[model samples]
Target: MSTTPPRLTTASGIPVADHQNSLSAGRRGPLLLQDFHLIEKLQHFNRERIPERVVHAKGSGAYGSFTVTHDITRYTSAKLFAQVGQATETFVRFSTVGGERGSADTERDPRGFALRFYTEDGNWDLVGNNTPMFFIKDPIKFPDFVHTQKRDPQTNLKSAQMMWDFWSHAPESLHQVTMLFSDRGTPDGYRHMDGFGSHTYSLINAAGERVWVKWHLKTQQGIKNLMADEAARLAGTDPDHAQRDLFEAIARGDFPRWNVYIQVMTEAQADTWEQRTGWNPFDLTKVWPHADCPRIPVGVVTLNRNPDNYHAEVEQAAFSPANLVPGMGYSPDKMLQGRLFAYHDAQLYRVGTNHQHLPVNRARCPFHHQQRDGAMAIANGGAAPNYETVNAAGTAPSGFGHGDPGWALHGVAGRYDERGESDDFTQAGNLFRLMPPDAQDRLTTNIAHAMQHVSDDVQQLQIGHFTKADPAYGAAVRRKLADLREG
Candidate 1:
């Protein structure tokens, strides 16, 4: 017998011919169900689309590797960094946070910078955003906060009225709101923007020592942003500009990279700072100033390969804050806690109950768990029962080992709402003051242009909030928008 491969066929191995054309009456008449080929093609085509992600809906991703350049063994005992010069295969997705699955890639919104590292121990996913802080710290308001960013239910159109109304009442949003209206909001593309964990995470060592840390992935390409005019034109001319840029760059061997850094604060330092300065270390809406705690470079992540199949690799990729490897752990940040639950739940809804079985989200190394059966469970679970605690089967160390390292907890638990000592306006003011004069002019003008679309009352209210951030900020915005007539 010849060594040639089996004959090519359709998914059911029913052998296909003339795939380029559908079965029709004289190649133009209505097709018949007897044409199995045509029926099969149409059936698959109808089911090609799946439910889109609820957030970070519009995105682009690539496959890559993260090589550890520096040893951070003192900070974490995770096996991924146990040896020097260790490299972990990674998948990273960059996305626009507030838009729908079909929204323009160039929208002036925060981008999701989520990374999944297939380490020897387990899959470690760091899901974050382009900006270092967020609009709210409390988890209770998160749903409403996101709703305001989304389309109004009745009109099904993005509403500035809803966004401004909610944000005006919650002054904590002033910091992020200011950043969103600035030129940096419309980044040139995914490659040129910075990424941050936003919330503080904990790191524990082999010796059980723990420290609070915030992860920052500074773009090696440097920060580049688009002006309102350039972004608007590109959105219409090439809505997929960022996605195409990433794919073409990687194909041309021009890999994009980012230098990963961590701002570490020791437990002693946290206690001392809290006692002396009264600042909560776990506040999600504020940043730990570089002056207070400097960034220590950890490693570099370079994306050198684009996904072969976008839907299988990129769209189905699932990431969550709960996918913690040893040495890395969670914090008490309420928003982070909420996301720990929300992200996985969303993945289940969007990608199926056994979404982790997909190649993009699957662990590279062997993983044995009693997770058993769910819809679309493709992996072989063997003859073992899905439930745990079987005396006969016997458990032998599996599933990321065990729970995270312990940390002391205090204070009486009750219905208590506490505030961090840091002011929202200080950082926002700092950001505004750092911009070059022309950039400041552009930011003011951009805010004026967007505010003109909103009602005058809302515009005045937002201007007042900007005034609270800084007198110059408020005055500049007001000066630019004065030409708009109030009816």
Candidate 2:
């Protein structure tokens, strides 16, 4: 066969004879108006960039394989975990949840560990944070919570007062606040920390049994966190340390991996819990107690290849808890329900409405949906009718298939307030009590360092919350902070 190259083509694959010479009057004159190909190329290039994510703005991604090492079919009907040794293609992105696009990776904040597993059945995304719980449980309070974490517009600086004010008023945030002030707040890097599906999910088995579940992706490298001083130093010296570390690790063939495990609870068991007795399981702020349902290891995920293009692969990647396959499903978790709408809404704003068409996020298997005609829509329904159950050609019939386990809802139609619960500080106190002396010392020092920057009233308010969690723990932090104030 001849070894010559094929004809050049436009992005749409239309053959182009001479791209070197623009359509012109006489060979050296002004360009003609008939340069459609040139115009299309330049226009597309000019609009290639979309807005970055508001949160998790700065991130890095890699391609990976998820291999099932243990059978979990009893828990989920998802084919990806149906059999031992089964493998699925996955794309994972690691990010800092609160910081801007240029924020330091080692900052004392939660990390986002979002993974998309493209299986034969469909796409399943586990969008979570390194910490198991959050600062607030109610979806209505989410925007307020985030606003506090962001910078103060008047000062154009991050406001610790804003953060503490929000946390102090929302007593339920104590558990997560305690975790955030601990060493775990400043993880050594993305690879050395554990990730948790903070929101509870529901998994249905082949037998149609439903169980509430929480996913944990334990870093195989083991948990490592930086001391407050060390983290501050690194943040100043190497702001992109975590992002660079992940990129360098994959490039050097030193792949990073995590062991996937899950803690599951039954509906009957959930009926007794104070929070879930009448609450939704999808709430993102509360975490299921591990003692009630211990974690069971299910599989291993190894990220082996870095994205060749950061903007194309990593920046364009979109993940949402709503991207569930057949076997895995959602719960009434209010926060989760809010995210179901929020994540996709954010994606539409940041990456255009047709972001799913991006190669990094497209399903591996063929996909069919009623979605049609949006900007950046690369794969137009392609001759297929956009409506279902239509007499038009290429229209497929629409009907409901399998649904979640049948459960009766006997509540009224009007909005109601959540029932009062006992102290939210108990679990946080337990976490503090469990920490070793050295870790506790580090936690106190870190809290003091952060609190010292805020007003004395805000500091007092935060210490009051801490004291409620554990007297001794609060006393230590107070003592350390008072010493700092005096000195």
Candidate 3:
């Protein structure tokens, strides 16, 4: 092998004559158009950035492996979980939901926990958040809800009034509103918080029997959170605190791990679960009671390697709930159903149509598709037929299999309002009542601090929802708001 340094060259492999200076007609005159290398460099730099994610704009990611610790074949036939001690290559990205790409890592927002498992069957993407529940249950309310979290269109600033007003009107948001005001909203960093497949999903066994399941990842490092004041201080002092912590910890070989568990409910149980608990089992805003459906250990996820290039690996890595292996399937969760379409569409627009050809997203197992050319078609099906008709043999691809088992659906096909259909406050009240006295104090105090700048009418309306959840809960918030206003 040659020991000499490699020569610098243009993208087309022509040796670069001079990289430091642009080719010019004279020493200080106009730059020459014939300078192909200079033009190439400038053009690439101009398009260097793809559009940032509308949500989860700021994030940190690492390559990891998930080792199956227990047998779950009785529940799912996914090859990655086929046997005990099986390990699957994985990539995990942790992110803050509402912040911009340059926003502070310590912002009081729900953290995104998106995991991708490269199984022999295909890539299984489990996209979720640190919390088990979300602000809304349906997709139609999603854009409006996100609008509240974002800047006010007229003022170009985040408005507390907007958030409060929206939440007051959408009483369903009370559950996640309670959570957001709690310490969990301001996690210490990426390594210390739990992750959940907040949406309910389905698991199909070899026998083709289906069961509803929710995924959970409990951090092995244990839960740690920052106080509101401390989080604010760090946001100003070190905006990239969480990103830095994750990279440094992995660099120093102190890899973070999470024990993966899933709560399973049978089709029979799912049918009556809502009727019994007064909570829709498929509601994204609700959580399955642990007492009713216990967490069963499945595996351990250990993130051991940090990405070498943030943009290439971390930023470009796209995950969708739609990317599921054979055993895994979707549920009737409205938020999840909406995400199934939105996530892939976002990637197609942001990352180009051939994003799956990108190294970070490419499937490990052999994949054959009739999908033809699009922008940046890196690996167009070379020489092979792009249509199924050319096969003549009429045999489908190896990995291709029958679709998921279907379930009965009975509902009027109309825009039915869910606000009055479900008992939203009971669960929110339960969560508030579950907190200890000090935690309850902190929760109310946090809510009051956030509501300080909101309109009185909006505040009163929100307080009423809280009161319905638990009278003491609303009373404490009302008192705290009063104290804040007076002082």
Candidate 4:
């Protein structure tokens, strides 16, 4: 017998009939509700579109595996990294922030680097961005900052004035703003870019010792980016260029890879490292200089398989910082703390409440839960207890309780929004100074072109931040903008 799946059928398992035509009173007359097939098609079509993500809506994803090549059990005892030569299946979604699903691939926006690892224990989602820092360190300002990047309320169009207005007022945004308006901003495609977990997270070892860590996925493909003109040309001609590039690469067996590395700081080192470096270690708006904390090589992640279906795998794929397996823990960083909640809540709204059950997001390891029924409940916990009790004998020792490791904590809880104490300008200045002269010129030119549409006052205010980063940096941008205005 030829073993094959049956022919195409309706969603309710009924074979479709005359799919090309709609049931009507007569030809081109009012449709009849009794035609269940037509009614089902229209209803499903109407509800097909779920809400697009507020950020990182324009994205591409792939299936891959991460092989642990180094011993990192001293830093984190997470099962995926427990031993050298161990491999874990992973799903990665690369996205452009501040754009709709139909937006251009080459737009100068931060590329989101979200990774979901299907380890032996469970799933661990490390959702991050291309840059090592963010525009705002506090979650309270996130919504406001995103609003500036989004469409203007009245015009329903992107306004440079809105973007610069927020960045100019927020001096702490300088580091990320500088990075965003540079040559690296317009990466050639997803393959030629680096990925970073922007926030500092804690990792606990088998000994129960905790340390702060930062993840870096340096592209093995090496860095390649499009010039502004070329980016604009491609944006118009081939909006799905990056998506096509990644998909075609894996299809032809030319797999893309990234070298995963992590920088670790002990709890004792975290206490006074800021005093030594003249910067806060936990600040999401800044990066720890590699000289201060060098990255230790961990593993190599390669995307060897292209996803079978885009909508079923990529679009439904959800990632959250809260999805941590054992041997991983949280940190006191306010941004990290906020994301621990924000990411989960965002997924709940964007994907359904049972998003965790989706294949891409679901854990490969056996998992049981009291999380019963709701919309899209693939597994309804049939005949199982829905509540936790001693007699119920819940999912073993875990029992819906998280023993997420322990750390030393002693602090007075209060509103700590004051950013003046943190030195934000020095690092940005250092980055600018470190750039080659040609890179510097490109950076300034990029900034000027992007800022040309904004008001002069907004331009001047943003220039002040550039000026604060480096006198030469600010002067170059000013001159470039002047030349543009004259033309």
Judging by TM-score against the true structure, name the best candidate: 3
lDDT for 266 (candidate 2): 87
Check candidate 3 and list the clashing pairs: none
Q: Report lDDT per candidate.
A: 0.85, 0.84, 0.93, 0.88
lDDT of 2 by residue, 122-153 (tens): 78899999998887776788888888888898
Residue 151 in candidate 3, Cα distance off native in Å: 1.3
| Full candidate order by lDDT, most accurate first | 3, 4, 1, 2
For every model shown, the clashing-pair count is 0, 2, 0, 0
Window of ten residues with lowest summed lDDT in model 4: 397-406
What 10-residue stretch in candidate 3 is worst by lDDT? 395-404
Candidate 3's C-alpha lDDT? 0.93
Candidate 3, residues 1-487: lDDT per residue as tens digits?
A: 9899999999889999999999998998999999999999999999999999989999999999999999999988888998999999999999999989999999989999999999998899999999999998889888898999999999989888988999999988899989988989999999999999999999988877889999999999999999999999999999999999999999999999999999999999989987788888999888998999999999999999998899999999999999999988888899999999999999999899999999999999999998989898988999999987756777654332534567688978888787787898998999998999999999999999999889899999999999999999999999999998899
Number of the candidate with higher lDDT, 3 or 4:
3
TM per prediction: 0.90, 0.88, 0.96, 0.95
Reference-based lDDT, residue 254, model 4:
91
Error of 1 at 156 (Å): 1.9
Best by lDDT: 3
| TM-score: model 3 vs. ground truth | 0.96
Q: Candidate 4, residues 325-441: lDDT per residue as tens digits? A: 988877777888898888888888988999999888889999989998889999778998898777665555531234445555677878776566777788788889888998899
